[model samples]
Target: MTLTTPEAPAGLPAPTTPGRGRGRSRRAGRADTRLPRARARRPLLFWPVTAAVTAFVLAFVAPFLVIVTNAFKTSADYRNNGPLSWPEEWNWDILADVWERVGFTQKLVNSVQISLGVVLIAVVLALFNAYALGIGRVRWRNAFLVFFLAVNVLPQEGMVYPVYYVFREVGLYDTKLGYTLLIGVVYSAFGTYLLTSVFAGFPRELLEAAALDGASRWTTLWRIVLPMSWPTLSVMCVFFFVWSWNEFLMPLVLLISGENQTVPLGLSVLQGQYSSDPTAMSAAALLGVVPMIAFFLVFQRTLTRGISAGAVK
Candidate 1:
């Protein structure tokens, strides 16, 4: 009887070598170690991203700070100090003066009334139009949709003169009602297109089911369509409201009198008419932004919700 041991081949380690197992163990350890280092490097790359966001935020907030500080100073103080510096004295006198001079209280009420009217009209028209184009049996719907989108591409100034002439011919100029109507007309096309897209994304089966349950078209729309489309409607309403409130150019040409003018138009007059007083102009500008800020604070949650819903399936 004989016993035999296997021979080691060339370019191969001997089976009895003491260091072979340790070498293999070390190789495995190195492979395992490389992964965590790669993972650790991921977070290190985020610093530039965070820095850019911080810079963007500062760029936006700085102008607001300058406006607020300038509003609290005397015209002389503004001349003496830098735009970013603190006011020597907390002078609210400019605010009072601007309010009285510009008739801010009356203008605020006018702006609110006009903007509300615009929102109501714009939302109603846009919803009906969207429903017709998106859900109802309509001929040339795609062509009309393209038309509406094309309307958004043109500058508003292109139509300003024609609109002004039409208003004048109809004797609707210089009235709050006229301004509201104009706002609705200008905003409807874009609104209709946006809302129609939203409507198209909704499940048609829900509407059909309601119809099978003996619901009328209008009933189904109010109950099923409108309810599910709340997020889109909310976003549109907020957008229209803010834009109408802040609209300056159209109102300036259309509403000639200070009494009928919106807040933005009145603020422009304040800036121009008080060119000698920087403090007063700054105070008026600050006052003008207060309503917008208040609105954002109140509806910011709805805004975020709407955006999230619109983006997700």
Candidate 2:
């Protein structure tokens, strides 16, 4: 009696025991209904996503394509046809002509000078300011941060009058030197705000360890923090460079001399009041964007790595 297995009631016909086949059939039936719904639901999601991505891609790429196609086209071809149509013959002379007419070499040099100057000044200022606010945890740091945010909030339009007046007074109104300093300081506001957040999240244990080793704060910063944050700083530098490079309104207002003008200002030569050269304009546009695009492509991997490495830290 103690060893006896439990038995079902006879009248219940042994509880109508089902074999693996019956259970398998039930599961298969459930899967049949579920799988079809899942399969049907997939296309519903996939198609919309594909369509949206395609729309966005075309929206962005279509203009670039137009620029590139028109860049190599002859004036007659561009005028006879349109921007979207392929060029009948590739007139490579447009680039050389546009280059010489606009003094592109000088303009590009000006752009590089301004961009590099801005990057160095802005990144350094941002790093130091971020360190003080984020790592040092200075008094009223939040207030200081708010001030930086406020600076960024003021649109260029609002500051233009005052800036123009001040620069005029200083006799820097039409100089590359003035533009570099002005744009660098202006761009640093955002960089300070961005780097502050990154610095605030820096590992405390590392700081403590450095202190234990008798490394001064300044020493620790360069020797340790700087390297750790190099990826982030590199990313920020790229942003500042691109921002200052593409600066239009400020350059337009300040740089009156053709020799002093940055790359963006050179685009003016492509257009005229009475008539504009569409092909030449396209060529200039193509040339203008090439450097920045190349810069971004080079740093794209660093940005991705910085973000991923940051998550772990």
Top candidate, metric lDDT? 2
C-alpha lDDT of all candidate models, in order: 0.87, 0.89
Q: Per-residue CA lDDT of candidate 1, range 179-215, in tens? A: 8997886688899999888777678788889889999
What global local distance difference test value does model 1 have? 0.87
TM-score of each: 0.86, 0.85
- Estimate the lDDT of model 2: 0.89
Question: For candidate 2, lDDT tens digit of each residue in 90-198?
Answer: 9988899999999999999999998999999899888889999989999999999999999999999988889999999999999989989998888888988988999
Name the runs in model 2 displaced over 4 angstroms: 1-40, 309-313
